[model samples]
Target: MKPSIPYLLAYAFTLASRRADEELREHGLTVRQFGLLMQLRLEPELTMAELARQLGISRQSLHEMVGELEQAGHLRREPGATGRTLRLTLVPGTARLLFDAHGPLMRAEEDFLRGMGKREIETLRVLLQRVLAHATDDEAWLA
Candidate 1:
């Protein structure tokens, strides 16, 4: 019997995450750390609460991850410009690490979708975007 769509999605997600994690680990980064960095890069000076909301994680959990990243010199947190919230800023060298990881990450994703044609890939992207948009009212996820 064929697997259900949800099961298939879960399996694919697990494999993709594992592979991406392995690739990122080679450069001293984890998938979660990379995601945090990417999010910060996209929106500089994002506050802890906003970031936690965007990431769908608890503020305390995000705080711990921020601490680890700060200790590793990948990012820093400072007082927000307009509020008491702490804003996250990526360190100067973070771009280099992100650049280094991009190739492998893209390759991993491409390999995962190896057999899909261009149109199929485009359709998949659209569907995923729709799902995400529907699941989260926050427009930041679309960005």
Candidate 2:
């Protein structure tokens, strides 16, 4: 039997994830932690529940990660506008951490796509976006 698209995609994702883990490990970060930070960075005012939903994790799990991040000085929670909600925001110096972490991942991607031209990469991105658009009900996370 031949490899299917889904199989190939999963294999590609595994390769990318492994590379990300190795690179992020150098900075004392796990992929999940990095994802949490990125989500908070993109939407600074997300409440715990909202963040959990966006991250596709449970609230309890998000809370645990939030505690760790807070202790590490990477994130903080403030009272939301409703006063009953707690909003997650990146800490003051978190930009430097994010910037530092971003470089290695991008470099890894470039290395992985070494022979791909700019136009080819753009086309690949567009195709992936189309697939994602078709697969998910909520496009908010795609933004």
Candidate 3:
């Protein structure tokens, strides 16, 4: 029997995430950490407060992750509106890791989109995006 769209999507995302995790683990990062780093890379002046809000994580958790990255030389704290703020350090080595990881990450996405044609994938993407948009605004949509 065929699973529902939600179930299938969940399973496929999980499968892809697992492989992505493996690749990230090789660089000592989790998905969340990578996202954090990416955000900081793009907006190198974001305060820790802004980052926490953007990432939807508590300040304490963001602080912890920032601490780890700082220890690993992946990021640095710099002057903000106030005393200091967190921004990712764009070291060449880390940039190289990001470049190295992109291929495998995209390959996983391509592999997921294989069976479905381009139009079908676009339709599914739009539908899922709408669902998520509605879900974020309404408790009933979630229930």
Best by TM-score: 1
Flag clash pairs in model 2. Answer: none
lDDT of 1: 0.82
**C-alpha displacement of 77 in model 2, angstroms?**
2.2
- The 0-to-1 C-alpha lDDT of every candidate, in the order given, reads 0.82, 0.82, 0.72
Q: Please list the residue runs of candidate 2 whose C-alpha ends up more than 4 Å from where it truly belongs after superposition.
A: 1-7, 133-143
- The candidate that wins on lDDT is 1
Q: What's each prediction's TM-score? A: 0.83, 0.76, 0.65
Tell how far residue 100 is off in model 3, in angstroms. Answer: 1.7
Candidate 3 wrongly placed segments (more than 4 Å): 1-16, 84-88, 112-114, 123-143
Q: Which RMSD values do the candidates have, in order?
A: 2.5, 2.8, 5.8
Worst 10 residues of 3 by lDDT: 134-143
- Report clash pairs, candidate 3: none
